[model samples]
Target: MNDLERQSRILGVLTERPFASVRDLQIQVGVSGATIRRDIEKLHEAGRARKVYGGVAALDGLPPRAAALPFFENRDIAVAQKRDIARAAAAIVRDGSLIIVHGGSTCFQFGCEIAHRNVRVFTNSLPLAGYLGEHGTCQLTVGGGDLHREPGILYDTSGAGHTFYAAQFFVGALGISAEGLLEQHPLLVRFTAEMGRLANEIVVLVDSRKFTARPPTVTLPLSRIGRLITDSDLSDEHARMLEDEGVDYIIAPRGGEA
Candidate 1:
């Protein structure tokens, strides 16, 4: 990785947990110890982190500590359910469509489902980008920004080379209530907002678990959503509420083909 890529990974690593040694960062980032130290100094200068005994520490009020678990760790939960959701979300894409894919475990699975199609995917997730690169035939456009490595998500959309527009936006949220879509990662929220602006269709790829998984912040209001693709397990009460709000949604069956 180059210096910028290495520094981005350092920020990502520290976001999940504190780093006590330069060696730890070297192991996670696979760069020289000297490079790691220089990266730490860069982070310190940027106000993203601070130098301490042995290694770097996440700055206060940065939301790194409050961010959700790493994306791979999240993929282990509700595997079949997530796959079902992904397939349902993928089915909506037409051949040659340009789609914006939001970050999160479920959306990554959605990318897996659409990878072989003759479409293009614009995204801010490095993990999603890498997944598409390895398994997808679809054209991939990864936005430039700091890499949140654990989740492989890119943030700070200002780094993008040009503005983008999409036919569809396949997105996932941390929580959903009458209030709106919720998220723990502030940067991810900003990225999502940008995606929402660039796409005509904002399709939310949330599973049944999110009905009660409320986070402290609202990323997008329910009114802006075009549709919801969720598992069959979504409860009747919440489904009814969606109707009251006029938010269209689709339920992917538990054991059926995606």
Candidate 2:
């Protein structure tokens, strides 16, 4: 690629991932070592990004926030596994059921799946609101709250105000720690807990990777979760925990796995 074209593309990658290594940029842009280095220098000169020991990162220095990537890019990252979990989750929706969707990429995918179904969706997620509002006939009610620009979610008093009703609520966690379903913010715990209590059922959509690590705050106890839908990579111990808590668990078959 020409120098201009290469520099522009490097800036774009830095904007998206924010923290990437030289190897990361090379892999992403499919350019040579020299090309990647030159592009990084150009970006640094433009004050768009800074180069670290092994890679380049956003000039802002913060990690790439969830909102930095639009809904579709987030969706495509774990395309097959998320779709499998989403499809399994979607099958549980009944006609005209009132569903509450928490804000996250996985849950947003579930929202996309259920949007075509005969259901009314209430969400605190900005992306889900946009997705369903555009493609579905279902009535969309977005919770009022302070917008969480990092994650594109609403998790404040305004978000919690709509908790008095809903047939089922779906949430995605940052990670599932041994402590329970975890998130990074205490406000998220309050909002998820309230919505979980209000809904008749609570479904936690987590891929297998979430089970191995934990985030900062507890979003729910296992007992509060009606079901856990994840990929087959879940360890037997974690699976046993869900079962012991009486949380119904569904493991979607991975690609080429039984």
Candidate 3:
């Protein structure tokens, strides 16, 4: 298997359990010990895993049930930009449309923008799901999986118990570049790809700041993104990059202007 695929498998194992021995990863990933070691080293460097004596462990060894403090920590960063982008994205959701909303602070803002809309939403965000369940009029379906609190995403590596499709998938990125939408966590990389497969089009919701933040792993290529929505702060150079990639984009106006 390739590096991305093998690393994803290793992370899957780590997510299902707390730690995975080098031998276990070798057997599961079907790679050599040296390959597993290298993968673990990379994961460790990316802050997604911790290297132990004989195995690697998920970051902090925290269970999936803990409260997602990180989500709240990020909820307030770039608040105005996220709200503007959310409003723009909300406009794209027609009444009675079905859409998949992936987990992230930015996506949570998008969820809030559509909380009372007459649409159907399938989401993996605990925060979004909770907000929608309490305040939304739209029909909602949540993914069945372990809730990873650090990233605030619910995902099942097995892809079990999920059988829905949507016209569009709305997601966020840790970083964006010529390589594609980047994420630091391997599970997120895998789950986002799975969600993309279930949608006819992919809509990216990212703040302009992410363009310069270079996360290490690419989740989707530029070709896969059908449209991108960002705040007005996006630079001309980055906008040209999207245009060159044939990606349709919208720059949301600030301060509630139309």
Candidate 4:
């Protein structure tokens, strides 16, 4: 099998079982020990699974993810990189365009940058919605429902269909991988999936660090993503992998870029 096929099988094992040792993966994938080790490295680098001793572990370990850095506090985690990504993302917003935006600090930066545009934005982020409402030249609509405290996002868990539609969805990821985007919360998976249905295209905005780790659950898949705007620090290996998958990997200029 090809690398993609082998990697896909490894991911399936990681998903079904908590951990997969190299020997076990070798037996299951019908590959050699060296091949399994290389597959593990590829999975780890792609943010699908993490390496632990002689095996790969699912992102399901660790705490329940009931906690997250507060919204204001998260603003400084990677401020410049987020800004660069936002700037690149904002360029795609044309006048009178309609788009959907999800919640996160990176996405918040995107909201802040695009406040002067003529597009109408539909969002689930409380801060972003409020910012657009107060200062954005564009029209702003907030998704109404329960408020999630950690990130202060509004999601309708009622399982009701969304009423709005947009040409694009600008979303951020806590974790990203070749297989898909990941997030700790199941609520976010449902929300993003629902939001994705309303848009003709999905644009993911995440920094380079997010690529090193996978979150507990898959929120969206790589196939659904039209474009990914990230910082310049993303590795060439990942860039090539994304190219192979047909994802438009946009490298936003960071402070040190040429």
Candidate 5:
């Protein structure tokens, strides 16, 4: 990985878990001890992380100020569910198809699951793009825009200069209710909606817990979503809701269950 990529990974690790040993960072980034140390030094110099005895820690007083949950914070929540959903989503992907994977923790897992597939992927998640650029065999394209550090997303406010399109668009949401797919931020709503328009099909990836969330902004209506892939834990009531909206749904089995 390049210096900028390494530094981003280091900072991402610190964001998820306050402290990380040099050894851990080395293993995760697949770099040498010397390289990890150099990246940590850069982060420390920038006042982004605290360089200590044998590792680095996130800055003490300044927590992320994002209105919505940051990528790191959402990454580990509903881990099993997210993995199962990703597996299901990956199963539906054709080997040579082109798709768009949007930013969010759940979609990040989906991106990783399909990293080695013989397909083309366009993504806006920095972490996902970085991971795929390093490990994926598929063609990868990142959207051009300013970065949203908290969500790890890149979005262009003016929505100009994008001529990309795909057969499918995979995305996650803050919540889903009768109204439609929901998000906590207006930019997310705008950008996600724009991406949906460029795709032939929209697939929603969310854990069952999101059914209970009631975020403020609606990104897309159920009518627009072509399909929904969620964990088996989803209640029959929500399944019926999707049915009522004429949306096809897939229930991904949990760990070890068939």
Candidate 6:
């Protein structure tokens, strides 16, 4: 297999287990020891895995590590659930209010739901901003920053210089464990955090699949979330966790009411 594909497999393995060595990874992926070492290096560089003595292990850092895959590929994994979550989140918006949206497939879907509304949108998501401009009457202010091609986000030093504000911020979680929300890139966190600061309320759109998974990094604490919208298939245990954290949440039925 190609290097990226092999590395994705390695990450899958590492995530399932714990730590592994170079020999362990080589055996699992059926690659040469040297090839395994190269893969480990690439994973470390991407902040997706950490190099251990023998091989490498998944790096589950605080939310917002550098994601190895591009957003398009990663986003397709749980699209239907995301769309459901987006529709529910969209139902909570009040017309004429200001909102901030981060960059991700789910957030893009959320943007789509609000496109025809008369609210204002401030964002660092390049793709979402572009989509909103096409169909939304909302005043769109694209956040200034370094554009990341993989995630289609404008980030870094862009929000630090601007003192813009919002009424609510809409974001999607890459993963959510008992620890909190996680994302794959530092830039994503940078912009998301800034958006959080600008908004009075924070709404997170996440599917049930993300409940147990741990992305490479963390984005925000569960306590910071004001509301969560998900699909009806989410587990009761996961729902309890949200309740325990005092996060108001709802799971809308597929193509049904929120």
Model 4: weakest 10-residue lDDT segment is 61-70
Using all chains and alpha carbons, the TM-scores for the candidates as numbered come to 0.72, 0.70, 0.72, 0.72, 0.73, 0.71
Model 1, residue 182: C-alpha shift (Å): 0.4
Error of 5 at 116 (Å): 0.6
Per-residue lDDT of candidate 1, residues 1-258 (tens digit): 788898888888876674435767777888888888888898899887878534676776533232365776566556788888888877788998999888888998898998899998898878888888887888999887778787668776465534767899888988888988988877877777777888888999998767766678888899999999899888998899889988999998776563
List candidate 2 segments past 4 Å from native: 1-76, 156-160, 255-258
Residue range with the least summed lDDT across 10 consecutive positions in model 3: 60-69
What is the per-residue lDDT of model 5 for residues 36-152, given as tens digits with 9 covering 90 to 100?
889889999999887854567688585322225567756755678899999999988989999999999899999999999999999989999999999888899998789989889
Candidate 4 global CA lDDT score: 0.82
**Cα lDDT listed for each candidate:** 0.80, 0.74, 0.84, 0.82, 0.85, 0.77
Error of 3 at 188 (Å): 1.1
Off by over 4 Å in 1: 1-67, 157-161
Better of 4 and 6 by lDDT: 4
Clashes of each: 0, 2, 0, 0, 0, 12
Judging by TM-score against the true structure, name the best candidate: 5
What's the CA error at residue 49 for candidate 2, in Å?
22
Per-residue alpha-carbon lDDT of candidate 6 for residues 103-153, written as tens digits (9 for 90 to 100): 888888888888888888887787788777787777888877688899888
RMSD of 3: 13.3
Tens digit per residue, CA lDDT, model 2, 1-258: 788887777778766655565665677788887888877777787787776434566766443332223343445445677777888888888998898898877898788888878788888888889878888888888888788776687766634355357888999886775567987666667778888878988999988756754456777877677888997768898888777667788987765254
Q: What's the distance in Å from true for residue 128, model 1?
A: 1.5
